[model samples]
Target: MTRMTRLTKWLLLMAAITLEVSATLSLRAALNHPALYVVVAIGYIGAFTALSFVLRAGMGVGVAYGIWSACGVALIAVLASFVFGDALTARMVMGIALVIVGVLCIELGSQAAHTRQTREGEATP
Candidate 1:
């Protein structure tokens, strides 16, 4: 990819991740009222829009979503425990770690597929 495309992808990825974080935070806040589907819908739509931009910039959907969700979950759990005084147990921590591992595996798998495709295309005569 061109440098500009790479930069744009990175920017879109950041935007996607930021929207996810915002959505999670808002949903957490809206839970008490439970009449905030509009707010939740807005958040979800923003997140999906940003994600589409990122995917359009060449990110694989599974890889992008896996990484985005892993990071979001970790951050949400941490903030939930600290900001909302939600329980933070060893089981939860382990679950978060497993999610991180899964994300990494998705990234690796995407990279492998991308590299294989690149090689195959190059070999076409």
Candidate 2:
């Protein structure tokens, strides 16, 4: 994909993360107030729509899903701690850190594979 396309895919992925997080928070609210279910549904639908665009833009499913889920989990956890007064224990923090690291590893691995393919193509006369 062109540089612009790649950039756009990444942006869409970010939007997906935001929408997913919003959906999760709305879910929490909906538990106490059923009227919030509409908001929750809208958030989830928007998130998946943006995620499909990211995948359609030539981003591998694994990498796209990894980033989307990792960021979504981390952000929701942090937001929960602040907004809902959820516990923020050391173990929870450590788990979040691990998830972030794992996603980074996947992303780096994908980039390395792409670079190798580009080099191989260049060397093919």
Candidate 3:
């Protein structure tokens, strides 16, 4: 893929993550002000739509989903602590760190697999 195309896909994935995080936060807020449910609906719908585009942009499903979910989880947890006064305990932080590490493994593994496939294909013919 061209550099621009790859950049566009990454940007769309980022948008998906942002929208998912916003919707989750909106869901929390809607508990107090029911009208915020509208935002929740729109955010989730938009997030999924953008995620579909990310998949269509030639990104592998496993890598895309892993990054999207990992980012959404990390962002929501940090934002909730600041926006809602939710406790961000040390244990939670550790869990978040582990999640990040897991995502990194997924991404690196994907790259290695792709490289191996390319090399095998080149050697075949």
Q: TM-score: which candidate is best? A: 2
Candidate 1 has which clashing residue pairs, if any? none
* Superposition TM-score, candidate 2 onto the true structure: 0.95
In the range 29-124, model 1's lDDT, one tens digit per residue, is 788867665677787788789889889888877778878788888878978898889999999999999988898888788879989999999999
**Best model number under lDDT:** 2
Q: Count the backbone clashes (under 3 Å) in each candidate.
A: 0, 0, 0
RMSD of 1: 2.4
Candidate 3: worst 10 consecutive residues by lDDT?
1-10
Candidate 3 residue 112 C-alpha distance from true site, Å: 1.0
- After superposition, the stretches of candidate 3 with alpha carbons farther than 4 Å from their true spots are none
Q: What is the Cα-based TM-score of model 3?
A: 0.94
For candidate 2, lDDT tens digit of each residue in 1-125? 68899899999999999999999999998999999899899999999999999999989999999999999999999999999999999999999999989999999999999999999999999
- Per-prediction CA RMSD (Å): 2.4, 1.0, 1.1
The true-versus-predicted C-alpha distance at residue 30 of model 1, in Å, is: 3.1
TM-score of each: 0.82, 0.95, 0.94
Q: What is the lDDT of every predicted structure here? A: 0.82, 0.95, 0.94
Q: How many angstroms is residue 116 displaced in model 1 relative to the true structure, after the best TM-score fit?
A: 1.2
